[model samples]
Target chain A: MSRPRVIARLDIKGPNLIKGVHLEGVRVVGDPNEYALQYYEEGADELLYIDAVASLYGRNNLTEVVHHTTKNIFIPLTVGGGIRSVKDVELLLKSGADKVAINTAAVQNESIISEVSRAFGNQCTVIQIDAKKKNDKTWEVYVDGGREKTGIDVLEWAQTACELGAGEILLTSIDQEGTRRGMDIELIDAVAKMVNIPVIASGGVGKIKHIKEAFINASADAVAVADLLHFKRAKLSEIHPYLISEGIQTRKVLGK
Target chain B: MTLNAKTISILDYGIGNLLSVQRALDAVGASWTMVKTPEEVKLSDKLILPGVGAFMHCANTLEAAGLNEAIIEHANSGKALLGICVGMQLLFDYGLEQGRCDGLGLISGYIDKIPDQQDDGSARKIPHIGWSELFLDEECPLFHNFSHIPAAYFVHSYMVIPEHSNHVIARCNYEGADITCGVQKENIFGLQFHPEKSAQAGLEILSNFDSRI
Candidate 1:
């Protein structure tokens, strides 16, 4: 059976890796490549580097970071933020990103999803949805680092993006993000059921059990953790083993 | 034991993630280079064909770049050649993606989309993206260091069904079926997964390939 991917999401600001609460009050952590290599060595299934300030800056600045880090880290590297065009996607891929996630640009021009997927394969294009609950069952989509409300229904946008040839969805919950409260199970379940492609549940993971819950309860294909890993509160080595003990298939843990 | 002097040429036929494969080779301490021209492909001791995208487009690009003939000649000369993902699919008789597209015909097989639903009547994800354990159906030099079944990362919607079962070197269980993951016939090898992104076990596999050449 295929195992749920454990991805370490490193939010970048300039050259340093940063962490924030609900995507605010950002604080610098350490070198991005340092954390990335450590995670790769500790058995992370994949690494996601999101430039938290890229959208605001109007250009991607993580290309050099990705190119440098990928030389040492062999696992799949996913880079997102400020990916506004097919040329941007081409630049990041040339810089060694296995996949490029588009959040703001995808919402603005849904055609970019199909454009990137057509130029590259669907596997290369990822649709990232920053969602916040608007009601009991409805979630509103936000863009521009979760600052602007697109007024688009989360499920509707996800389904449309998939129809536009998105191979995967990276669903982030604004309410649960950086809270350590755990993933939005309802949101994940809703989107996973709505789309045929794999959905990666991100935000609000406090412990290893939360990761397992994202997989078992929400049927998420992968879980992306940021605060827990960036803060050194949990290690992937222990997390993978704990998940394995719970009968969750995972990539074999390596190193000490 | 070092491959310092020997540079394994990774064919850049205008598609696929070649950097990850290059990093994997670097991790194994093997020298490598990216080759696009026919002369570069002919000069390398070993070649790696890595690709991603539509099969018809990839096949057509390879043919237009004259990489098809160069790759076939390289394989026929008994030099080691490896294909990953769509590159592996391009080694077969033909691909049914987009339309019926002819492959390099390095091996007898056809590429087709994986079944959408399993026998259990449950919906199976279109692109089988994630890590899965590989069961060695037949021993091959590519997996020499692995003491047991190792999981590798896979991201694809289509699968290669070789003409001869003996060519299948490894299989992985997906949904309710055992899908072919690796194929080996003579010096030519094909892997449907991204071993470069598969962590340490994948590094071992790349090291094995490097050592064999």
Candidate 2:
């Protein structure tokens, strides 16, 4: 098994970094690139950039940010939001993003997943599923940055997306998003068990222990932190050591 | 061939992350040009083939662009040539993705999908995305200054199986199945991962490649 990745997710609106609670009540953080560079220096395994308002605007706005980030940062960068067609995938990939995560467009047209995967290899395509718990054993899928509920079962959609050729699953829990509590361990465990692809748990990382719990209890292959890392509550430098001490494998922190 | 030689050529066949590779080369302070035509391939001191797409389509594109012959001719002339990801797979004799497709045959090997199931009958994920440690099986100059590189980021479903075991320079263990991660045959080299996107360790590898030319 590969080491669990520690990814820093940056939710962007235009050029500024934004954060929200339960995927609502948005506020600016700072320049997206500045945080991205800080995370990169702090030994983030990968970087995820989502244009939080791209779908609402009907087009992606993170291309320039992606282009600039790729020029400066060397870690794997995944860009999502408003990825509607093969051309959109092409544009982002050309802009230097290693992978493109699609949610809203993918739920609308499932074939878009296969199309992008076929054109640019399955590894280049990621399916982002914003899920909210419906009951004890079910979660409803959401699109357009968790604003629209699709009523699709999270497990069912994840399996279908994997079958359709999504290399990885970026599973974000809406109920716990921006709550600064902890990741939905049940949600991550359920999806991680169902899908063979790497599942990145996102949306509810409060402390360093939460990250470790996501990997240990949830069986997540990667844990993505936005509020924890973005707001300066938890540093990746500190997180890596804590994870290593807890017997979880992670990439060596550079310049230590 | 001095160690600090700056000029490098990256083949562009209408696919792959050419700019990322260019940015990496730039970060290493090595001058590079995107080689689109056959003439540019001939004029380049070293060649880097960077790709991120299907195997058959990339092979078809190389044939359509007449890059296949150019790459082979350049390799025959003893100029250093490196292939990244699907670019690395294209250097093989054939690729099994989307049926059997012919490759550059620069190295005697074939590209095939990584085993879907591990030794314990557990499902192994396709694409094998994320960082994995590289166990160097052979000595090569490309790994110079690699003491600090614990792992390089990998994002691929298929891997190359070289016919000659000696050609396999490095191996990465994926759930007990040892997969070939690097191939070296004389001046020809193939890396299954994206060094350009693999942080500082990746930059060191790129710098090593630049120094070899």
Candidate 3:
């Protein structure tokens, strides 16, 4: 098993960092770069910045944020939101992002995954699935930041994306997002089991226990925390030690 | 072409993430420039080859751009030459990614797909995307201060098997298998890990390379 990573995820709308419930009704949190740099200093394993409304606006605006963060932050950075094609992936990767997350474009075309994988190595392509549970055993893929549905089963889509050369899956539970209740353990577990690629469980992680649940219960390679870090409900300093104390292996964040 | 005064030259054939390498070199306080043409390659004393995308495609792009000759020549001249990721893979004689393809052959090795199954016959994650602990096995001065035996950031679906064990400077364990993470033959070195992105440990590696070489 790979070492579990605790990622500080920042969702952006326009120029401001924001958070919302069930992928809607977002409120401004703070500057994306400021929060990102803080997490970097606090020993976050990695940093993820998603342009909150890029899908609706037909553009991504985190290029500068990525540039600014990588200036001093010395960790892997994954940038998502509205990244649709290999060219879009190229832009972010050039701007200092180590990986690019695609959802709307890949779901709409399907072939974009293979194209990006071939162009920039599968390691550079990430499939971001905004999933909402359709039933006890099924989750549907949503696009444009949960504003639209594709009727695609989340498990099937994840497997297909993996076959099409996606390096990792950013599986977010629309239902549990920003709820501070917990992660959609069932959804993440199902997708993680269906594919051999790493699955990063995103959305709805409140307490330190939920983070452990994502690793032990869901087998998530990484857990993305937005609400907890954004609202100061938790800190990565607390999260990393808790995991190790529970017998889970994580890289020692060499921070003060 | 004049071998200008830039301390390091990152060979840019338009395939990999050159900006991050640029940033890392900057953070380590190295004077560097992007070399795109064979003539520019001739002007570089210390060369860093960074690669991404399919192995065959990257090999073809570098060959098509005619930068390989000057790079090989630079290596032959006893100057410091470093390859990162696919750039490191290209130093091998052959790469079996899409098909049998030729490489710079600075070192004797082959680049091939990482086995779908782990050594224990369990399912292994392709691309190996994460930070893995690296074990230093050699005492080459290039790693003199790149020390601390830090964990590194890695992202690739291919493996490089150097023909000689003496060339391997470091190794890392993955799924009960010992994979070569670093190779060095004199001034020519290849690193499977992305030192440019490995946090402080990475910066330390880059800093060591700059100061030591």
Candidate 4:
């Protein structure tokens, strides 16, 4: 098995990176490229970019962003939001993204998952799921960046996505997002168990303990940090060391 | 633009990440071009075949565009040909992907799924999507004088099984399974791991390739 990955998530709104709570009340953070480069230099394993309003606007403007970032950063780049078809995936891949995550469009048309898998191999196809806790045992799937409720069970959708050939799942908790607290360990645990593909736990990572819990308790293969990284609550460089201190096996780049 | 000195020609079959490859080449201070036409592929000296999807899609596109012949000719001419990931898989004789897909057959072997069970009968991920430490064969010229790293980035479900054991140059131990990740036969080289995304060490590998062959 590969080591657990630490990824930096940047939510893009037009040309700027933004921060949102519960996937709402958005505010600009800074230049996404700058933060991405910083995270890469700080020993981050991967970087992800999700267009904040691409699904609502039915357009993704991340090509230039990805193009500019990959110039120096030589890690895997996974882009999400408004990716509805194979053409969209090709555009992102051509723009230097190693993988792509689909959510809103996948909910509307489930076949896109398999389609992308066949067109670009399962390794590059990622299914992004936005979830909100429905109760203690279940979570509802939300779309359009957590704005629309699909009434779909989170566990079931994850399994379906996996069966449909999605290589990885980017599971974001709507309730815990941008909370500056801990992640929804129960939610992540449930979905991570439901899918065989790698699950990237996103939302509500404020400190090192939250990250450790997500990895150890939730069995998350990777954790995508946003608020914790963007708010300067912790340095991207320090998180991995803390994880290592706890005997967690995370990826380490050479001479970093 | 003049083809003054044989530049690094990357065969773009509309299925691979040519940009990142080009960027890696540029970073290594090697002049490269995204060769999309069969004519251009035939005219190239140092050719790179890149694929990043289902074997059937990539194989079909390569054959349909008549680029496969150009690639074979380039390889047969004793020119150095590098294949990346799915491109490397295509160098084999057959692929057990959806059905039995014909490959370029530059090397004898089959591409099969990594299997649900490892050597110890333990379960592992199907896609095998992450970085794994590389165990390279020192005699192989591909890694000569190259900087060793912690690991190279890997993301694939299938493993290449070359018919000739001598062709295997590097292997990674995954779940007690010593899977082949790099292979070489004279001027033809194949790497299952994506060096373009493996950080600086990866860039150095590309640089080494540029100067070596």
Candidate 5:
């Protein structure tokens, strides 16, 4: 059986990593690279670097961060935010990014997904979907840094992204994002059921139990926790065993 | 045919990070250099193809740089050659990515989209990224210092399925098909994962490649 992957997400706005109450009142969490190496040493399987200001700034800071991070760490890094074209993907990869995530650009120009995929290969392109539950019945998709509402159902966007050669789906819940209430398991389960590719469950993780819940109920191949890890509330050394006890397959703990 | 005293040439296609790959060679203390010219590739004992991009673009860029024929010549000279990710796909005969395009044809195979396994309405996702275990088929030099089920980082959607299964050196099960993660022949090797970014297992794989040459 394949082992479940544990990923730590770091949301960067300028030089600081912000922690908030549901993506609102953000507090700086110190240098992004400093936090990255912390999780890396804690045995976090992968690191996600999302430039929160990319859409607002009209550019991605991945090239600068990735170049800086890859110099100190050896783990794979996936970057997202404001990736508008294949050239953007090219620059990120050249700068040592293992994978590039596309959200707004892929939704606006679906062909860009295939175009970038064809130019770089599908493995390098990741489609990040930020969904907010509008009500009990429908969820709206947000693009351009969650500033614009597409009104399109998040499910439809996810299916289309996979068809366009998006290798992985970074499914995030805007309503649950940064809440630490728990992962929006419903959204994760829904997306995981639809996409055959590896689905990474993101948003609404408050504790180690939330990670376990995300994996077990959502059946996600991996889960990304931002607040819990960023705040040093949960360490991977303890998380893996907890996951194993909960019937999740994990890579053999290296030291033990 | 012996590469007893030769330098390994790493092809710098200007698409992917070559420094980490170069550093891996340096970590094992292997005599290697990044070769941008055809002359460098021809004289090397081994060739390392490292790249990140669409198959056609890489093929085109390589041809444009006058390294395509040089690659063929290197292989024809019986020099060991290895390709990573898109670099690995370039060793095949053809690729179906971004329309039809020709490859180096060093090995017999083609690159195709990862077939969708969801019958219920999921689109087949491209760019499979993450770490996966290698189910080694035969004991090759690449596994010398690595554990049996060493984890390596991967980031690709399309993969090489050679006509002959004998050429498959390692595999990782994704969806249902045993995706061809690694391929090898007498003097050629290709991996769909980035060994440079794959951590210790990755470094070990590079170390084994160095020892083999």
Candidate 6:
């Protein structure tokens, strides 16, 4: 078994990462650059910078954020939000981002995904899908920072994105976001079983066991956690050993 | 006659972020030129091949740009040639990344995907991102300042399985197999990981190359 990759997600609002109860009221957090380095030093596999307010602002500051993060941290960093065109993708890459994630833009224009993939290769392009459980049997895909309901099927979107050359899928469950009730494992399993590309399970990780479940149950390549790591409830050292015990491969945590 | 500074020509095949590779070279006072032409390759004292993206795309672009002949010519002259990441994989005979893509064939090996060593059979994560320690075979001049270092950035899944084991300079533990981290064969050098982004360890490796080349 290969080591499970750990990616820390930095949810940005304006210039800083913000944490809120659910997705309603938000409060200012610390400098994103500082948090990013902290994760990098902690030996995070990769860093994800998602502008949570990009759709609200109608613009993303990923270029500036990526430049700052890369200058200090040498790990692979991915930037997402408001990435609409190939030029937008190129700008993020030029700004020192290893990969650019597209969500709403990808759903709006499917061709953009193929074009970016063709131009930069699949590795540099990732498709993000925000999903919400709509009924007992179905989940609806959300767009525009998980604000608008696309009403598209999750399975269909995941397959389409992969076919269009999305290297990986960053799947975030709206119903599970900030709930800390653990990930929507069923949804993840459904998507993971469908897509050939690696699926990174985001939104709803509260404990160490939850991370293990993500690997064993959901079949996620990497788990993206926000509040758990940010709140210091789950340290890398603790998680590393726990996952290894459960027969999951993870990078050995160096002495802290 | 006093010798002037040697120009390290980096092969540009429309694949990599040359600026990052160039920046690393510049930091160590290595005079380099981003060469896209065959003439520039023949003119260089040292050569670097930096690549990103698919193997076929890069190989085709290099052939179209006449870099293949230039590289062979340069290597035949016994000038130092270093390949980074996919560029490193390109030094082999062929790559199994997507299809049976032909490589430069300077080394007798083929690039293949990292198999999932896990019993569950779900460990085929494409990009093996992040930093991992490199275990060296023998202390060589290429690692003068970076001996037995346990920290270096790695971001590839496909690796070269050399026909000759002596060509392997370094290996990193991943999944089941000892993944190839660095490869060296006389004047030809290849690294599966990015030395530029490997921080101090990377800098030291480049420094060693600077002094040796």
Model 4 segments beyond 4 Å from truth? B1-6, B119-122
Task: Work out how many backbone clashes candidate 1 has.
Answer: 0
**Model 1 pairs whose backbones collide:** none
Report iRMS values in order: 1.5, 1.2, 1.7, 1.5, 3.2, 3.5
Structure candidate 4, residue pairs in collision: none
Cα RMSD of predicted structure 3: 1.6
Best by DockQ: 2
Greater TM-score among 2 and 3 belongs to: 2
Model 1 ranges with Cα > 4 A deviation: B1-5, B147-149
Q: How many residue pairs clash in each candidate at the backbone level?
A: 0, 0, 0, 0, 11, 2
> Model 1, chain B: what is the TM-score?
0.95
Higher-ranked by TM-score: 1 or 6: 1
TM-score quality measure for candidate 1: 0.97
The first chain of model 6 has a TM-score of 0.96
**Tens digit per residue, CA lDDT, model 3, B82-190:** 9999999999999999899999999998987777797667888776877788888547766675545378888888889999999999888766657888999989988
Angstrom error of the Cα, residue B156, model 5: value is 2.9
Better of 2 and 5 by TM-score: 2
lDDT of each: 0.89, 0.89, 0.86, 0.87, 0.79, 0.79
* Model 6 per-residue lDDT tens digits across residues A1-256: 3356678888888788876544546667788888887886776767898888786666877788777667656567788988878888888887888788899888888999999988887877888999899876578899887789887999999999988888889999888888889999999999988976778899888888888999998788788888888888876657777887898867665644
In model 3, where do residues sit more than 4 Å from their true spots?
A: B1-6, B146-149
Could you tell me the lDDT of residue A189 within candidate 5?
87
Off by over 4 Å in 5: A1-3, A106-111, A147-150, B1-7, B23-32, B98-101, B109-113, B118-127, B147-149
Model 2 per-residue lDDT tens digits across residues B40-71: 88787789997777899899998999888889
Reference-based lDDT, residue A197, model 3? 90
Better of 2 and 4 by lDDT: 2
lDDT of 2 by residue, A66-150 (tens): 9988888898999999999999988998898989999999999999999998888888889999999999989999998889988
- Worst 10-residue lDDT window for candidate 5 chain B reads B118-127
